[model samples]
Target: MEVMDLGILSLVPAVIAIVLSFVTRNTVVSLALACLTGTLIAGQGLLGFPTLLKTSLGSTSFAWVMLLNTFIGIIVAFFQKTGAIQGFSQYIQDKKLSRKAVQLVAWFLGMFVYFSDSFSPLFVGTTMRSISDKAKVSREKLSYIADSGAAPVSVLVPITGWAAYLSSLAIGVGVIATQEDAMNLFIKAIPFNFYAVFTIIFVGLIAGGVIKDFGPMKKAEERAIKEGKVLRDGAEPLIGKELTEMEPYPGIKPRVFLNFLLPVMMIVVIAMGTYLTIKSAKTMEAFLFVLIFMGISMFVQGIPFKVIMNTLTDGVKGAVPAIIILALAYSINSLSKTMGTANYIISVSEGLLTPQLLPAIIFIISAIMAFSTGSSWGTFAICMPIALPLAFNLTGGDVTTLVVASFAAVAGGGVFGDHCSPLSDTTILASTGAAADHIDHVKTQIPYALICGGVALVGYLVLGFMSI
Candidate 1:
């Protein structure tokens, strides 16, 4: 069914949803309500919400997300069950690294496993958690490192899933004439991806102890350094207790080099190899390949098949909340598209924004929208169609720096929410991977994210006027 033209009121659903997300601090509920509101508005009555949701769930993209994230959960569980995480940490510990060195290593490992953002937190967080704890590092800090390592690192690198998908969005906006043009623009936008680049630098500063902790993070850091507590007292970790508490099978020694290194190498190699050759990285396929390889390796090591199956089930169980969140995220994005949220926002701002302020305005709007929705990809889906065209027109068709700045704004702004929002996939995974309390992870991470956002905000404002 076609949507009713609500004119300016098309903004109401998203506004309410964004308000609810802040007031309730419940991501799934906020997004669902938002989707329902938009769907109802689109239908001009109460009956259409269900149909909109049903369609969203049945969509191919939603199914792909479910499978992709489900596989990631299974990978996390399999590694934990097979004791690959523990073995990797043990290997690190045996080197007798200091706390600083351990954090630096974790920071680097996050970037090292940069093939898939979906896989990075589980791989880096699970593997590094033990080592970070041993080094007296706070779980909150570890979660930050893992998230920063995954999304920000992946965003800047063209070979990863983030770049490939976003490059397509650039093409969809009709600014770039072809996929090749979009890819070239993506390359040019890299340095202007200020938030992502600054975020990576901030993580290094934290890991290297150049940036002192403040906010909730400082308290968490103090507890870790002064009291030797990795997680705060009575905090509930997002990852299942089963996975975190699981042990290696009896009398089967885990090998860091064989089990950990080999499987990780396979995931990276296949992800990059396929992307370079085929243009699509196919992250889920890479994960499945490593998962099967992990299973065979475990079987060779004498792990019981039943135990492995159970471990995989536990992995899926752990990811259920995240999966629900992802579904709701897609639903809202689709509904908002139907409701004309992006067009309304653009229409309202059309006369008010000057080209001198376009980049800054786009950056802030994209960041806020992404943060409220808890999906950077969805934010890109919404904002790119409007923002890209605006920048293209404002600068007389991509001839100047404004076009690149706009692309960077959308990309960086999208990642800004991924870093700050509790509902973001990377943020959630970072908490899960580090075994940190979900809310605690968000509270501790947001301050640092704000720091990066602030810097990027200023940079965009400068770039905006420079375009004039």
Candidate 2:
């Protein structure tokens, strides 16, 4: 396939993709459709879609991410089925903390389960829902806390699947030639991920009573305190009784350490240990090790072999949506490359971008893309390839402070948008876990998320000039 400049027209595929995602609220379909549109625009006709899929999805990076997420899903299912998460929740209940303390505890728990953004919110929301209700904490508040801790914390942690996928995307772009360099760049950009950092801190402040609630959240909090109603009157929670009320297998006792904590510890130790000794982090290997350990431990604890297999299959099934989105994302990325979309943008904007404006602008654009599409990983797939290369071009192909700031802008912006978007999986999961109304969760979270986003924008503006 020959790469075509397409001039300004090269932006058509991504633009159509983003617009279609917002209008249809279906990222997978939007991406696929956009790919077809791209093929037509590129003069490749209908056959280009298959060629694009083959070239994009048939890669080592995609395989690694797909497998990593599959293993992660299995672990999540195992944790749910074995009642380790419930056991931890029970342990927290035993502490008999105050309302503020319970909120803070939920926040901490969310950050502790930092490996998967998808897992953290569901675990924290479910774990804290009953406890928070007992303490007169609103479901809105609980959902906010759960949602805030998820993607914000996961992206900051380097030993997780987010890091693996993100760093993999950076490989062969600009100065990020190897996995180690890409991972290193990711780490170096951490401090500059202002939106995520600020959002997490803001949540802690609100949870700990250091900050007062405002907007719809304030009203919900007031209602919870005065009327002793955890949910708004007539509110319909997104989740049902069947989903919220999960139990361990018959006659099996839930052990938090064996089923949950130990496996998480293993991932951390293995990932970080490999990164320290061998430069590149063996993130996928760490997950694989933990997956095996989890299965063996569950089997030892009297779980039937058939049940274990069933849980594994369910895990794979749960992972399908994400896998499909990633596959489409890769295809679009390939399409964008073939069209030279980023190159066109760079060529068009070269004279307009200033050091003081670039990072802030990137942050705003990335935020809009993520919020509209409501998929942070999808946002990453589209934005990173464009953003990183632009950064490299502006910084003369070196991984300088300017380049790092630009990278952080994209990452932080995506998280900020994810936090605010009602269509986001983490946000919806937060509502389900807290048993809160889905729309109510979205309504209450926006004000808080915007405040953090606003502050982050300013931070980016300052850092951009300083870096340059």
Give the best candidate by TM-score: 1
Badly placed stretches (over 4 Å) of model 2 are 1-3, 7-28, 96-102, 113-193, 206-246, 355-449, 462-468
Backbone clashes under 3 angstroms, per model? 0, 0
Task: Report the lDDT tens digits of candidate 2 across residue range 9-80.
Answer: 776776776667556656567778988998999988899789888888888766875677567667767877
Please give the lDDT score at residue 370 for candidate 2.
67
TM-score of each: 0.89, 0.70
- lDDT for each residue of candidate 1 in 191-242, tens digit (9 for 90 to 100): 9999999999999998888988889999999999999998899776777666
Q: List where candidate 1 sits over 4 angstroms from the true fold.
A: 1-53, 172-175
lDDT values, one for every candidate: 0.79, 0.79
